[model samples]
Target: MVRQFVSSGSTFETQMGYSRAVVAGDWVFVSGTTGFDYSTMTISDDIGEQTRQAFANIAAALEQAGSRLDEVVRVTYVLPDGGLFEQCWPAMRDAFASARPAAMMIEAGLASPEMKIEIEVTALKGSAA
Candidate 1:
């Protein structure tokens, strides 16, 4: 099977030796993506806005891998404060209301204090149909 690696131009990817996502056959595995806007390298303080930005980053990676949010089959969310998870529900629902993939959430410390949330996803290419 041919495997392809997708990059989001984030310096961390290079420094950490990882791709934004990897496509293996019909599967796309997106790395844990944060809310920092790749273009500006800035992140929002609000959890809701951070959540939306994280989803946007994930969507971009999935799109680059020949997949989409609707094709996602599994998702994992990490937040420094579990209580803030509720604040992300609206954005999460908006992004995955269609696919409604199996999901999990974990409370954990992020690399930086400014990083409120990180999301990772797995998608099966063309699975949405």
Candidate 2:
């Protein structure tokens, strides 16, 4: 099987020794993505905005991996505060209303205090119709 790695141009990917997503055969596995804009390297304080940005980041990675958000088959969400999960629903629905992949949410501390949320996804290439 052929393998490919996708990057969002985030410095952390290189420093941390990981790709934003990896493609192997027909599967695309996206690493946990945060809200920090890759260009600006800045994150938002609002949970809703962060959630949207994280989806945007994930979408870009998926696109580069010959896949798309609608092809996602599984997703995992991590948040420093579980209470804020409710605030992310609107953005989540907007991003995955169609795919609605099997999902899980975990309440956990992130790499940094300012990091409010992280999301990871798995997609099958050409799975979306």
Spell out the clash pairs found in candidate 1: none
Cα-lDDT of candidate 2 = 0.93
Candidate with best TM-score? 1
Clashes (backbone N, CA, C under 3 Å), per candidate, total 0, 0
Q: After superposition, how far is residue 76 of candidate 1 from its true place, in Å?
A: 0.3
- Mind giving the per-residue lDDT tens digits that candidate 1 earns over 1-129? 988999999888999999999999999999999899878778998999999999999999998888899999999999999998999999999999899999999999999999999999999988895
- State each model's CA lDDT, in order: 0.94, 0.93
Candidate 1 stretches with Cα past 4 Å from truth are: none
| Candidate 2 ranges with C-alpha deviation above 4 Å | none
TM-score: model 1 vs. ground truth: 0.97
